[model samples]
Target: MTGRHAVPEAIPQESPAPAAAPAQEAAPGFSGRLTAPLLIGSLLNPLNTTMISTALVAIGHHFGIGAADTAWLISVLYLASAVAQPVLGKLADVLGPRRVFLVGLVVVIASGLVGTVAPSFGWLLVSRLLLGIGTSAAYPAAMAVLRDESARIGRAAPRSVLARLSFAALGSAAVGPTLGGLLVMVVGWRGIFAVNVPVALVAFGAALLWIPADPPGRRAADGVAPRLGLDPLGIGLFTAALTVLVFFLLDLAHPMWWLLAPFAVLTAALVRWQLRRPDPFIDLRMLAGNAALSRTYLRHGVSYLLIYCVMYGYTQWLEEARGYSSGHTGLLMLPMSVAALVCSLLGARTKGIRGPLTLACVLLTVGAGVLMFLSGDTPLAVLLLAGACFGIPQGLIGTSNQAAVQAYAPARAIGSAAGLQRTAQYLGAITASSLIALAYGQSAGDHGLHLMAGVAAVLGVLLIVLTVTDRALRGRT
Candidate 1:
């Protein structure tokens, strides 16, 4: 935590004239002009992730496809995002975050338009792929922008600012199903995709107006020769490895054990190739050295894994097992969303990481344990109470782990580090989906829900152990 406040390498050198001082003086803080655009941009990925949940049925019916075919619509985005997040994040670090951020929004707008006019299911898949790549850029780029702002202001970013980001992401995801359901009812499945156009447009416009321009010759200013060493070969190998790994994870119910062989080979090749490059696509050496940041990634992934399991699994159980309608299930889950929002706001006001993180882990474990007691005969009050238990941890863990990453990552590579953080979360989400499928089989039942909960409880305990044992996080804010 000693260098947690170190100025980012991308910060521009100040001019030696007194006249240039006024411009620096006029620069806005995190809550000033930067807030709206950054928050709006960061919400896109999670919003898109869950928004389609309610629209899947309509989409499958329209395309004359089964659940298996429509399943690709969901898997494709996770697959594309799992690869694109790190790639775009590295680009944000090298090419400048503002430039990358704006470009990503443009891509998002384009994807929305593509989806709106898509002629077939194949075209829709293409749209989702583009959406994944586009949305993946926002979070990492926003983190890099925050780093730049912090360096310019000569202090660490407030925990409240990070909390606002968590709020936006969590809130948008929670509302996505409701929004998608309304959109589908009003304008059909295309509305789900078409909706991105206006949102991206507004975000793009706000970003252009609010986000400061990147200083010229960033690499040169840092005393390195300007070069775009993107390492295409290394990127290819990483993508190949990740794609294979995701395919393997998605098929865990049947266990496609053979895919592991190619995944291992590609990973080995990627490691070997990256180690030799001066500007690797992913800096393995850096990750090896920064154990605290690495742990933050692990914590983030595991936390999200448990959250997604409960979110999707619990919802399905309420619908199929408890015989609740989709509308009723959404209403029942409202308590979770409300609790998460409140806890996120509360968690952000605290400066210490360990306290909230430990509480979140404890609550998550307790919530999972409570899930085992759920039955069709369970009272509505008890169901609502259970949702709130899980929601509290969702809010606390997201902000605390995010703050931990900000505290531990190297200033020079903050963008890439943020990207990898997101990649970990996506991997966790994919794993959750597989776990749900394995447990629930053809339909969500009481036994399957309890089984998933048991696994989540175990992971929750592990998260607590990891959080309490990490000495690096002891005094980190």
Candidate 2:
């Protein structure tokens, strides 16, 4: 029913060129470049999350405020993201992922313009929320485009290409901290965002020119484009439920016991509503029936949680306890990006071999080992090495896990599949970080390190569990 369903192949061939009209002149691998802009253009959205993190303390100082109060900039973005993913994803599939992606590009560009003139932290929060809204388009839209392109190729790509497509997209995350940090230093945090304006312009221009649109003559088997009739009511309920849930949990450190009751009530109501809907915003059945699929989603979610805890928490520690500058912190994170980038590319060669999963498991276990080894007095070299270890897994997790999910998900429901995938990514991050915060967040030094290691160790074990479950599930089928 979705635009992403498998299309019948035209003929047998060694390589299947993607389905689309050729432009005025063709270059080698033209379709690849045609698709590149989607992923490349989308990179800055997640990059914003990483780059702004190191600057939070500095920005707080600039605004004459405490870091605690200014934490909303980050939370608001996450809140926007958690709420935005389901709705924007549904709309992208129906209205056109390209159109939805452009909205994100525009939102980020406009936010940069506003941040250039922001008067206070409150104004910055307003800009960040808009930025979040725009970024919501990047991941789902990028993946959806790639999914469609793969289907259009009209021939099965031997799986490696699929892995390559995903990891390559994820590999862009490696560029985030490195690029964002350098920009923050050269032009300040606003400049970090302003960089998007040019990238968006180019991507917007390219999308209009190169990316193929669904042809006019072919009617969808469903009569209308599946996107035309997305369940708006389901979308509303889903977003409202998630936004409220994120808010309640995000404020948990305040010990808001008064909110606990109502939050629970609202969440329960949302689930019941979704269950009864003719077209639930997210299909719970797909997630429920598939163990491999479910494990992939759970691990994907948990992995990001671990990475954020490491990335943000370390950024805070380096500044508060060890006296590193924002520039230095970003610089230190570069090796991580490099490690992740390399593995993601290399992972393209390792599909279904257990190589990617096994390597990921090894890297995370070692990364956890190195994290536990870190200390306030530890030398910078050792800390950077620790990050590199973590980066290897961080880089592969998004792409590799996504590839696994898609490899196993039913073909017709790529949008919902991705929605489920993105959902786990958000859920993993929010739940894991929230727990880590509760355990040792108040303490600002080595004690936090020790406690965080315990959290990482537990997560590492969970990753192993995920690996086992995936293997067992694959075996059953």
Candidate 3:
């Protein structure tokens, strides 16, 4: 699955090539000009996902809403992202990634402006929904760009290059709360929204300058008719199915089990429709045939389920049960972020995918087991150690699973595949939220933390089993 092959060499260009030149002629390696734009673009989704966490209270107070209402501020983004990622990814594949990426950034800028001046909570929801859809374009579009660059260069993307994208996402997410808090302190919750304008503008400018223009004849290259079809019915069914599923998952504490009926029906209809289309929005048949890619998505989803459980649940436990201030808890959690950053670099340097993944699962299991020993009086060192244990796996799993997706997915479908990968992660995140809500209902006490840890431990063990038994991953690096 490593993308090494002999192909025609192409000269690297810092500036845009003429429109007549083939789009794939830009570079022969993952150069700075190429990596810079992708790195900046990739930061949007994770940054937006976490940054809003710190501002929820201020937002709720300002709008005179309860926790449940404010909670939608978070859920709405996840829901929108869950639907938009693949849809935009499909558009990127069809319309050209550069175009889709730029449009997405523009949408982000507009969303930020709307959010900053939102007159009511409903407008705030609209802002978040747009933010979700806008940010959704980055990762998948970047993935498609990377794949195209790799093909142009005739080599697999170096692990380090791939890791840089992971680093951007992880680092941005790690700092989101701190950054958001500082912005809120200096300029109120509006700062969180307003800040996106300049950052996105810079990214947009860089992207415009550095990223190569799309080839003029994509449809021609594909040997298809000049007019392209986007499979709208498939997209609509997919959106409906995912929306129903996300809502059901969001309210798992008091689940609307009846929603499952519609979800199942939509999914079945989607499957039936997709199998008949030459250009389905989601290529279910490809997934059915590609067991390795299918497993990659499952592994990614389960791995994140454990990670979000720790990221969100453990922090709540620290503040509520251990009697730490939010600031102190954030400080304590710093070790996890630091460890994840360091290990991501280290993981990128390694060659074997299964080994790192196996090690990650083991560490995850050990971390969960350590959580079992925590109490109000547990030493600070022990807490830090637990955090590091979980952090190590986070870095390893993220890069490894990403590489697995790149290695396994069909070249033509890389964009949508990457988007589905993110959808898997968001689903895991939503599931983790449900799990935390169930375990820590009124408060994140010692017993609740331990109960959650037990579940996490079981999940970690399952990850280990999944990793070890997959023959497709045995010789992959």
- Tell me the number of clashing residue pairs for each predicted model: 0, 3, 0
Ranked candidates (lDDT, high to low): 1, 3, 2
- Top candidate on TM-score is 1
Best by lDDT: 1
Candidate 1, pairs of clashing residues: none
Kindly give the stretch of ten consecutive residues in candidate 2 with the minimal lDDT sum: 6-15
| Candidate 2 residue 442 C-alpha distance from true site, Å | 7.5
Off by over 4 Å in 3: 1-31, 53-71, 117-123, 144-160, 177-190, 219-227, 323-325
Judge candidate 3 at residue 53 and give its lDDT. 57
Give the per-residue lDDT digits (tens) of candidate 2, residues 242-350: 6666666655567767666766776677677666765666655555666666677777777777776666666666766677777788888889888888877765554
The list of candidate 2 runs beyond 4 A from truth reads 1-33, 143-168, 217-224, 227-229, 353-355, 432-444, 472-477
Runs in model 1 lying further than 4 Å from the true structure: 1-20, 26-34, 57-71, 114-122, 144-163, 181-189, 212-214, 219-226
Give the per-residue lDDT of model 3 (tens digit) for 1-477: 111221111111122334565545555567898888788878988878767655655676688764345556666787788888987776776688899899999999999999999999999989989999988888878866765565455455675776688889877776665566567667888888888888889889989998878766554224452345577898789878877887787666688999999999999999999888877777777787788888999999999888877876787677567766545565676787778878877877777789999999999999999999899889999999998898888888887887787677765455566678888988787777667767776557888889889999999999999999999888776
lDDT of 1 by residue, 363-457 (tens): 88999998989998999999988888888887888777766766777655555666777788888877777777778766678998999999999
Order of quality (TM-score): 1, 3, 2
